[model samples]
Target: MTTNSIALFFMTDFSIPKPNHNKALKTLAPPSLAGKGAGGLGFSPLIALAAILLNLAPTPAIATTVKIDRWSTTSDRVTLKVKVLNNNRIPILGLEEQAFRVKTKDKFGNPHTLQSPEIRVLSPEESHPQQTYVAILLDMSGSMKQKDTARVKKLDGAVNAIRGFINLVKAENLPVDISIIPFGEGCNHSYQVTTKTIEDNFKSASNSELEKQLDELAKVPVCAATNIYQPLTETVKYLRNRFPPSPSEIDAQDKPLPKLSVILLSDGFHVYRNNEPQQFENVINLLKQNSQITVHTLGYGESLAHLRNRAICFKYIPDDRLTVDDVANGCRLPGSDIQEFIVDEDRLKKIAQTTGGIHEFPEDAEAVAKSLKTFFTTLREYEIIYQQPGSDRATIHPTKIEINSPDRGINTLQSETENIRMSNFIYRALTFTQRLPLLILTVFIGLVGVLPFIQWSKKLKQQSDL
Candidate 1:
């Protein structure tokens, strides 16, 4: 087909550049587009039309492009990246099926596809089609100084678990983006210390550097006040900006919004001022109202019990505390006879349940490692694609996402998904008062409706006076 005719299908009011035109079309077309003698100046109209039709024909339907990311932990949880490409190495978008299938050998050595019903689909785009953001929030409070054993510290436990989680995510071999945010008295607002750096520096850093940072985390003394709201608010703000409202607000379809998954870690109570609860509630309620982000909280110590209980009151946690003995172990240092090292595991569990996150208290290095492994593995298995009805700027649209799996002897799972479906809602920038024309019309209508009744009442009063 002529380049002009080919351009019609691919371009809208905004046109693709001439240089990239061929590449874009090739990425979308079937193999027939590459056939010999398909393009020529002297070809008959009929021949040209036939060639064009053949090129436009869809490819044989098989499996859809499903983006997959894997994450794990070493000393803490690590965010994993997974990108799915076609044979031409171009990123695929909105695949027919976006679920992750694990191929493992059973005892007989036969490969089986472990069909995990949970799958998440990302928005479609030519470049960076698969965008994923996983946030690991580590709690670095004084309670983390507790001792697990004579030789190892509780901080050591936290580091080991986080490190192991990171290692697992790296093994997944997907085009994934990762971020790490560590919180204690308050989240490290400094750019150098926050997880936002992961978008740029995480993948490039050597394993040694990653370990160095984790080691230094212990030496950094915990601040006195444990303001969980600050970090939580910061995390929500970052994700909202990162994801934006929708395609229209974003200005271009080529830029797909990143899927946000927050993993929070804390070992202290949320000491917000009396007014702070309302502010925290507003922020969280705004996030829940949007249906675009999923938050998972991990509580680490006995101090966290209060925070966990309060967090659960809001139904934000799915499970209880993700405590590591190393945090308690760190408190029992030599010559420091501190008997109260173990954190309240029950409280931690409640926090996890409220936030819909996994709660576990790992006693040693091995258990910590295994817990990290499970957490990452579950993340890799579950998948979701956000489907809001209108523009991201619409702000108040109800979002509904349907997860489907045909092979696992399941026909439908929508209802079950809804009850456990995490809130991804956000508030629109414009409030009801700002859209005042409608408000004015309603006021006018109310006045009109009440004016006749007032007039009738006045006439009756005058008649009675007569």
Candidate 2:
């Protein structure tokens, strides 16, 4: 045997099967005598140690996977949960919470600035929340029946988005129960797909059943007018009815309130019940009052402002009196048809803002699917601790947050200013609470001063009578 082959045979454990066994053996003696016969096999203990060192060396730019799970805020402070998949081999070692930029989009699609979110990674790291409750409110108004392209309709895109969520739930095996409520003219509660839950240990049969229910929602007929308020209002009531108003219900249940999320898809405004368009604002405010709920609204086609403007034009002028040239040139719309297909943007914004939810406007049918995926990313678990913005808690506050990771491509998440229930101590900051102690001291001082005055008056009156 050659000197090199002899050295290699000794260095490696030849008894262990490896790719080069035959070639090494062919150049040497048979296995039975090779260890004993190959002239001292030139093996050193250092050689084995060197091989292990090479394997342990670090690679270039250690890859990182950061996912934004869930984010929430008090009226002032923002907290973010960022799931860092590779915590052991983090690319940006010692990354701080201040390294991210967080912002929220307005009804105009403009992202307003906010403070950087404080980041926290949950212990015993997880990719998904243990459980979730989703209410998918789909709009089945007459406008949804309109064709997007020659072949695709708006409802087709909505179904695709629903299918995307179903596939996501199955792939992740998330324990989520979904309720689908289709609304137009009024909500068809009978036609609604009630809650379907996926157990902790996932079952294929359960998944198939959920998929079948989604298919049913896809087949609901399109109806005239839009009752945008009913589905949202009813779904909230349904959720409340499921659980009684007891603290123990939240504290004792395994998944208790399991993160309520409402995904509302609408093409236009509330015109079906014409007298109460303003009622939507009240319903949205009610959603905001419930701390457990977060509403994500997706607007399809034109902006709500554009739709409302067209409706206003039609309300003032009758269609029969308008000229065809005026309609073609954009001078005036056929007032008769304007309110039938309008979207109230300001009311939608109010709902989202009060509930710490997101509002998205996707211009085309295809964009709807993409936006749904983005919304799904928000349904994760992580926590952040940061200084609360010192603002008046009694009134709604204007909050702005921003998070950025320097020297990395990690995108900043949206932050919001909404109602965050304060503790008894922190609650003292709101309204008359701060001035309470001072007011009490003032009253005590006044009582002491008035008592001395009364005693002096009584002594003087006694001397005069004597």
Candidate 3:
């Protein structure tokens, strides 16, 4: 048929969602003569049909809301804190191992499928099965002496806040070994809280004694300056010593090594003496090097903007070493010799981010306690253990993780795909040597069954001959 005839037929037959198709034709046609009606202007219905078809066509699937609360890789396994939300944005509970699949890709986009990854849904009420080691690092700079509107000193409020954290941990029955580290000027080993000190105090002390110890910790005199860097190195070293070199080491040693988490309370200032820039570099490097250590920074007493701006400089120092040139470039204004006094939030955030931890700046001491308590509640997260197949452990790999409802077929709403880069890459080879015991057991069982069958057959044949 001719194009004009087809257009005419479509225009006459098609219906439009309006006063009428004739009115739609009038609207589509440009007004040249006011007297002209809908019949004179030619309008085609094919355009509307094409538009409907375009709208109806399938589009790319949207990712459901999901939060990767924390993730870390080790010599033998990758651990993740994943929270999947449904369409209503609530955390979905009771996910099994079969609900998740992990895909690790090298820099070149080569996919490495893990043998089996474990997934456990965390319950906010219950404590995690693994033992936990926590070191609470309290900043004792002079500014911490300032009181809020409630007439309570900052230091006192912080101590009270931490007391609540300890109480919550105890209530949850989390097997936690706690340490309180106080940092400031001119305080050598005199006022520092070490893991040994906490363990020693708790070993013989009752609950009331523990409270007394906390009071003693809170009473540490505030110093003129803050030395966040040195304390961090100490805390990380202490926590790392608690963890085994590999996950398998925990099994081999037959001891429960606790997971390490550091809760640092600071006024969001890094005012260390002597090479302040280098101190920042050291802290950042320490966190990056120890990926297993989770550092949560709680900043109070300053505007978050001030805290966040100071933190941006940390992005420049990817490694431990900080040259004058690096500082001049990172911390100073472009083409200006004058250096800007920066806040410490950015670096603090980077430390938390790299270690799969979190940073928060609460408004008050009460808020601080509440946030810490909330954090402790979410500590019970699922663990996924998968066998690594690839040999390349040096390069960073991009990982895409998927979670689903295992038995709910076809219509199940998948969790949002998590795209993250894997750090602290450790390669574990899956070799036949590890399976020797199983092989031996299987062979021995087979031989025993065969020998019994042969004996029975011989006895039956002898009976028949008789």
Candidate 4:
């Protein structure tokens, strides 16, 4: 199809909501557009790149939604991560086990049920001295020095807003550890993957340490280049070191395996100074290798967005005029090559989608702050565990997940596909503390059930021998 025809097809066939640009979108609707069908669409002769990126649209604004991240099953236990968002796209936390009415189906399309449901506030990932590790990668590139309409340096705005978000996290009183990395100060030109630290360090400090470190962000000098790849690599490396890569290892060594997430706030573009782009691919590999780390991205301004357009446009701009904004933004008129920039929502979205995280484009610092608060609140999640007999393996997956809305209605959330691998579990892996009650039950069964059967069988054998 011609460029105009393709653009018209996408415009009519899908309903990907435009970014608020003025405000961060509130509700992250489940991506069920194709399932429900499309609305009327109209388009003029435009470009083809716009049509393709149309599918990459972030979660639409719809009713409440739920995403089942993954199902990790060991022989003895099952850990599930379900993310539920309200109509406003805000996360819904504090739901008790009763609220999670789960239905099950097997891979064979047969009836399946999870026996002996053990709902615990304590799991490998949450509760019982809960710990959550959050890392904030802030962009302090030279472009950050540019002032907004309010004459606020983008860096200062982000700093002040993040400071407020930290206070909000403090109020939750949950065990949340936060680390701030301000990258790209002078290192951009020097070709070093460096940061101008708030506390002059690249440490993931928690509690009061965050306040001291954040104060240094505004005063730190800005740099001319950015290596988005380095900070992403460092964040993943830190978390991987702190926690084992698999659920089995986590359950064996840790009492409560903490939740891991990273927030990348930037206003410029990604610099390839040397091999940053290639390194970015490696970083993506680490994330995909069962790290279970969610990378939430916030595009702070228009610069990054512009760069994203250019990247998309580069593929289709008339060969005669290769430099232009993305087609979706109507960069049909060619100009100089688009700059390498951040706020590249496309790149940010890819990272977030890889780890089942959220991505937002906030226009200014205040909007950025609001987005940060949403991040803090959404980190609080409900972890559910299901168990079954040691000798049997049952296909267990959540079919229907629903919750009673505060507004006097029941909101039903959809479930995604999951993988469950059963193990040859001869005995349940119970902790020493859990074994006591179970020990008593074993003795009771022996005396009342197994012991009698054994004695009768022995008596019969003796009679036959005589």
List all candidate RMSDs to the true structure.
Answer: 25.5, 23.2, 18.4, 13.9
The regions of model 2 sitting more than 4 angstroms off are 1-128, 149-151, 186-206, 243-250, 253-256, 272-278, 304-341, 383-466
Looking at candidate 4, the ten consecutive residues that score lowest on lDDT are 1-10
* lDDT over C-alpha atoms for residue 434 of model 2: 63
lDDT of 1 by residue, 1-466 (tens): 3211111132122345334222321224455554445254343567756777766664422222233332211111111234433222222234334443333232233433333243233332212223456666676655566654334555677677777777665665434555556665443432233336534434421245666677777577553445566666677677677566552222245343555666665544454446754765665565565445655554443343322332212122223433322233322324542323334454445434444445655544455555565455334332333222222321222122333444422233221111111123334445677879888988999999999999999999999999
Q: Give the poorly placed runs of model 4, Cα more than 4 Å off.
A: 1-81, 85-90, 93-99, 104-129, 185-206, 273-279, 303-342, 383-466
Q: Which regions of candidate 3 deviate over 4 angstroms?
A: 1-128, 149-151, 187-190, 193-208, 218-224, 247-251, 254-256, 304-343, 383-401, 404-466
What's the TM for model 1? Answer: 0.43
Candidate number that wins on lDDT, 1 or 3? 3
- Clash pairs detected, candidate 3: 118-384, 118-385, 310-343, 311-345, 311-346, 311-347
Give the TM-score ranking, best first: 4, 3, 2, 1
Question: What digit string (tens of lDDT, one per residue) describes model 4 on residues 1-466?
Answer: 2111111122344567555332221324456532443231333234334765665564333336766544455665665566766554456554445545444544454545442244443221253325677778888777777665356778888998889877776665667777777677355333233333322443333456677767766776676566677777766776777676664324565344677888888775565635645765777787898557888888777643343333433233343332213333433224432342335666776787777677878767777787887777666655566653332454433344344433323355455544455444524767888999999999998789977899999999999999
lDDT tens per residue, model 2, 72-104: 444444444554323221212233446544344
- Model 2 alpha-carbon miss at residue 326, Å: 16
Report the number of the highest-TM-score candidate. Answer: 4
TM-score for each predicted model, relative to the true structure: 0.43, 0.49, 0.52, 0.58
Where's the lowest-lDDT run of ten residues in candidate 1? 414-423
lDDT values for all models: 0.45, 0.53, 0.57, 0.59
CA shift at 150, candidate 2, in angstroms? Answer: 8.1
